[model samples]
Target: MPRRSLADLAPGDLVDDVFLVASKQSRADRQGNLYLTLDLRDPTGNISARVWNVTKSLADSFESGDFLKVRAKAQYAQGITQLVVSHLEAVDPARLGLDPAAFLPKAPVSIAVLTSQLRGFLKSLDDPHLKALCDAFLMDDAFLADFTAVPAGVREHHAYQGGLLEHVVAMMTLASTVGELYPEVNRDLLLVGCFLHDVGKVRELSHQRGFDYTDEGQLVGHLSLGVSMVEEKLPLVQRLLGEPFPPETLLRIKHMILSHHGTLEFGSPKLPMTPEAVALHHLDALDSKLHAALREIRDDPDTASRWTRYDPKRNRRLFKGSAPPAAGEGEEDLD
Candidate 1:
């Protein structure tokens, strides 16, 4: 049988396929009967599913990252498609005959190209100490491998394979151009800050099966872990420089990582206090927000409407009007 995509699912369709479990939760309905709620996904998209009257043994048999052989009936409800699962079982990849890559969303850019671009940005840094620090990250074969493969987040932004590298490259490119416009901003520091700001996500998220948080991710969070990663590599950077790295410079870089989230409620322990820190915060925010909005616009199912469904994260709906024509596309001569 041919494969079915989540995007093509509709009301009254029978669903029998392998899907990556994005999330799994046991809940109780009105009568206090136990049920399982799931976010099942393939590369095209995800859908909410519920297995009514689930048993404890069945719930204990699987997790958020496992592949499930699901048999369900689709129903449209609450403006979204959901599945009423009749049968579900954990399944091995080899038995399912499905490629894992086909089940997960990936960055639009290639990992090799993003890595090359990231290295190019790192090489552009002139400060010996900053260059050494970046080298400590970019030159480590193991770290670079993970950094290039991991997602920037589990959700809400660049939440796909190679997303971290894509986000970093975009931020660095924007920082380079924006830094030139603002001479007061420390371009090297800003660029380095972009590289280090989200590096801890390589550990914070588990992408081997699907994007999900690791135990350490939930306990310490990425911001704190990011600062620790920098501290761990500082001695290596100092050794590469053949001299003691400046205490102030190291602290500034760490500050940028710690405060890049921009606000306490948003997870930054400290507000952006330096010019470079402030620039990093805004630039990172711009990239993340734009990516999130674009993902919403692209994934929205209401093609009949001119605006996307309300994005609770962004607190607004995005206009879905066709993009304005370019200069030569359709404009008439102004004679």
Candidate 2:
């Protein structure tokens, strides 16, 4: 049976359902029993799930990145939802009945459709240098396959199938409107930068079952890897197109990719130095944060007036709204 959400939970109910998600398992207490810190994400929203009651045998089998089916009771703590685990299983392929694909989060958009739109946007870029650079990178068969399917984030906005494409499209939308206000920011270059900025992420994430990082991804990270990919294409662009892209243009585009977060503390190695970089940085942040809010809104009303605890994604509480009474209808009249 499909698992019920924490919002749909009540005390003493037997939660026989399994929630497949990214997890971290660690040992604690006198007997070296274990506790689980889990990132519980469904299509609805993200929650922190806890699994307690572990002995050596149970602790030994529980590993991070492995799926676990938590049989637990729902409890609210400090305005957050938690599952008090009863029986936990390291989901064995032999008996697991739930649809695996349903568990992984996804953007509510079509990948094929969004990909075509993205390609159309790329085709429209007029700058020879920018268009050539975008073409060289985007035309790769393997990269396009991964890019269309990868998640933009592990959680947050666009953390589903076709998520990467949706995120890029959203960024392009934000960049388009913002680029108009700043006349100095080259329109085509800005658009190209916005689309290409996160291309490095195809290597950064391992999206097979759950979103995790490859060893290379953990060591090099996305921004550094992105710069390396662009440099790889630079040789090709120069060879075929001649004259090469001006060094300044390459530097500016790379800086936008490197510094789109606008600060060193935010994983950006440098600050946004140009007007285009500044616009790209905020537009990127804008789509991410805003989409997170939009997801929270969708999850809020699903259970109808019940509290959704607090969403860390939104940094506040979400609750279902009461339905308005119908015209000329009375609650007592129905009875």
Candidate 3:
């Protein structure tokens, strides 16, 4: 039988398939009985699950990152679909004939297309120093592979395979279009800033089995890691140009990367201080928040209503009204 993705599941459906264990926890109920809470995932999405009357041995059998063959029934509660697991067992991938690709979500855009667009953006940069800096990353085969595969975030944003690349391309496209509106904004700097702002996510996230933070990612975060990556490549960039790369220009680029989060409270050590930095921050934010909102609407299960379930991340309910009629759909043209 074909595997059913999380999106395919509906209330009252029976489930018997393999899924990745995104998270697992043990908790006691009001009756002081132990139960297991889990987040079971497949490429399309995840569902919260509960295994009541759990045993210590059952809890010890699996972990947050394991793959399990689960027997469950889908149920709706509090406007969300959840799994009530009756049986589950950790399974070895090779033995189950499971393909790893099916378990992880992927970006809508193809990797080749995203990589080509990324290279195109790098080539568009006229500043020799900036071009060299970009080359230090884009030209490296291993780094490019990781950058292409890593997600922009664990869950809040573009949290899927090839998501980092997609996020960068979206930001770069936005930067290009908006930069023309404000001639005062340095286009090359802003474009490069958009590309590099999340480059460190390549290291910050682990995508082998599922998207999760690395030790370094948790300890230092991407902003500082990105700064260190840029600084580490400075000598090579200087050597490529065969001249002293201007310190002031490098500092400005670094500033954009460090401040693209837009505020100190949002994990940026410094707020956007330069025109290009400010533009990059807003462009980045626009792409991320819009993507999050669209994903929420698409994944929302409340099809009976025009409004999506309230999104805690966005702090608002989204309108899910049908698309308006196309230009000549129903009424005859009066003119």
TM-score of each: 0.92, 0.81, 0.92
For model 1, residues 87-186, the per-residue Cα lDDT tens digits are: 9999998675777766777889989899889989999888999999989987788888889888888877889889999999999999999888999988
Please provide, for model 2 over 1-335, each residue's C-alpha lDDT reduced to its tens digit, 9 standing for 90 to 100.
44456566654555555566665656476876566666665534445667676666776775545567666666666554566777777775337555655667776788888888888878888788888888887778888888988898876678777888998988887777776777778878889888878888899988867787778889998998888989989888887579778899999989988998789998999999888888888888888887876676665533454555576645777554555578877746655
lDDT of 3: 0.88
Worst 10 residues of 2 by lDDT: 300-309
How big is the positional error of residue 234 in model 1, measured in Å on the Cα after superposition? 2.3
Q: Which stretches of candidate 2 lie over 4 Å from their true place?
A: 1-7, 25-33, 40-48, 75-82, 92-99, 239-243, 300-335
What lDDT is obtained when candidate 1 is compared to the true structure? Answer: 0.89
lDDT of each: 0.89, 0.75, 0.88
